[model samples]
Target: MSEALALFASSWFFVAALLAVLSDAFLPLVPSGTLVIAATLHLSDTHTSPFLLGIGVALASFSGDLLLLKFARRGAAWAQRRLERKPGAASAAAHLLAALETKRARTIVVARFVPGGRTVLDLAVGTTDRPPRRFLRWSAVSSAVWATYIVGLGFLNEHTFDTTWLSFAVSCLAATAISAVIARVVQRQRRLARETEAVEPVTVS
Candidate 1:
């Protein structure tokens, strides 16, 4: 308990957390959300403020997203070429483009929860003809939502359960389950969109 409190109270710990969440904007498998959850759980009994941590994490993630968006916008052609070389990324980018056209904010928020979706969507948005300000507004919303959800999960679990491991385990399981469901929904939406596009007839005036 003492060690956990010491680590959570250290300034370096929050710095590392910010970096991890920031890097996760580029790396899909960084487990940034999990790190936030763990930190929240550990800091439950400490003087460290979970609300402040969540805000810091959200801002860090928002910064990373904007940075990536700028890179994608400047290197639009290069980013598109690279994404095309990867089948999964290419498919995701296509769906994200379609989704963005209709449901900008919701798509951004949903994609943030789906593994690897954020990177693809960010690149797609950057390369599109849409206004950058729109992406910026929606990205901020998604980041705040993500941070709040992860931190709240950990905080509630910690207070509800006496055993530390049990709380952590339950929180992780819940997070994973939610992630999986969102991914499945995204996949289904993409499939339906593809079929509709294929069936639609093209007309030349």
Candidate 2:
């Protein structure tokens, strides 16, 4: 792991950041915050500009988000069909499809902070037929904020690995918890909307 980190850090911080961002789209196992921190550390050692590193990471992350969103829009049915081919996967797939159909906006916005949820959110938004422009605008803003927070943490504590790791872990946990809360709120709002529509009186013309 250290060797991989060294190789990534040695080549170019921008490349490392780009790869990290891309990996997040499909593989949540990749620790984006860890890569950002590692890149920051390497840049600091080489006297590279931290601001540029941050920008590179932000752009790369946004690109990944955009790609996932496009895939979600164009490939959802294909993906579902493929998933359905696998025995015992139907139940999970059905639940995911339902979630994608409902609470798309909330899922996308909240999943920006969750590890695996980012790609899922993008696909959900796409499958639900949410406007691309609106989703992209919000996604860009969210990615910027998320990147800034992680990068800022690295910048502040450049020398302490223990402190940085702890901070990153806490941040991830907090983000996940917040996402759960948002999902609940969105579900409640949808239920209320349905109830309201059901109760409205119809006027005969």
Candidate 3:
């Protein structure tokens, strides 16, 4: 590895990344994306390997998924009771359930990329009785793709800019823009799904 790469490749950063991702599972406000962007910028400037960066992110994310899954498994009944008491939670759960019916793996993967979407989906998955093996299988793919694509975006921005700070600014702006777009798209899809549901006729046996 190059000197620049070696400088940031310490166990400390790897641990930090792991912890941030793990916490972000429950805390949607965590700056995991910022951390990944900063790490990628460092490697890009030094002309070193970013493969390990990708690995660190993906594994940490997977760990978070497992943690939430376990929590959901244990507290599903209690959570459901509470969710049913809250109108917002009930609506979110209904939308999540509807999405699951349309596409399970793809929904998981898409949500992983959207801001705050992962937390909702994680809780949804846990609240439902999705098998561990199936959830793991889909989560593995989602985590891997999210890490690679997001980090790759950082690399792209760095290559386009002359300074690390400049790239970081551009990348953060782009992330915000993407998140807004994703939120809008999700809202539209949910609206359409709800409308479709409302119009469907009920039949008597």
Worst 10 residues of 2 by lDDT: 88-97
Error of 2 at 160 (Å): 6.7
Write down the worst ten-residue block by lDDT for model 1.
5-14
Query: Candidate 3 residues 1-205, lDDT tens each?
Result: 5754666564456567568877898787898887787778877444557788888889989989888878877999865765576556667766876777778888888888777678777777778765778768888899999899768888899899998889999998887788788878987988887898889698999
- What is the alpha-carbon lDDT for the whole of candidate 3? 0.79
Question: Against the true structure, what is every candidate's RMSD?
Answer: 3.0, 6.3, 3.7
Superposition error at 77 for model 1 (Å)? 2.7
- Candidates' TM-scores? 0.90, 0.63, 0.84
For 1-205, candidate 2 gives per-residue lDDT tens digits of: 8866765656675576669876687666777766676666566455668787777777877888888767757887954554456553344333444654665455455566654556655555556655688668767777777777667766666554456456556555554466567666655755675587689798999
- Global fold similarity of model 2 (TM-score): 0.63
Model 3: runs farther than 4 Å from truth?
Answer: 1-14, 44-48, 81-87, 200-205
Candidate 2 deviation (Cα RMSD): 6.3
Question: What's model 1's lDDT at 86?
Answer: 79
lDDT of 1 at 149: 92
CA-lDDT, candidates in order: 0.85, 0.64, 0.79
Model 1 spans with C-alpha error above 4 angstroms = 1-10, 200-205
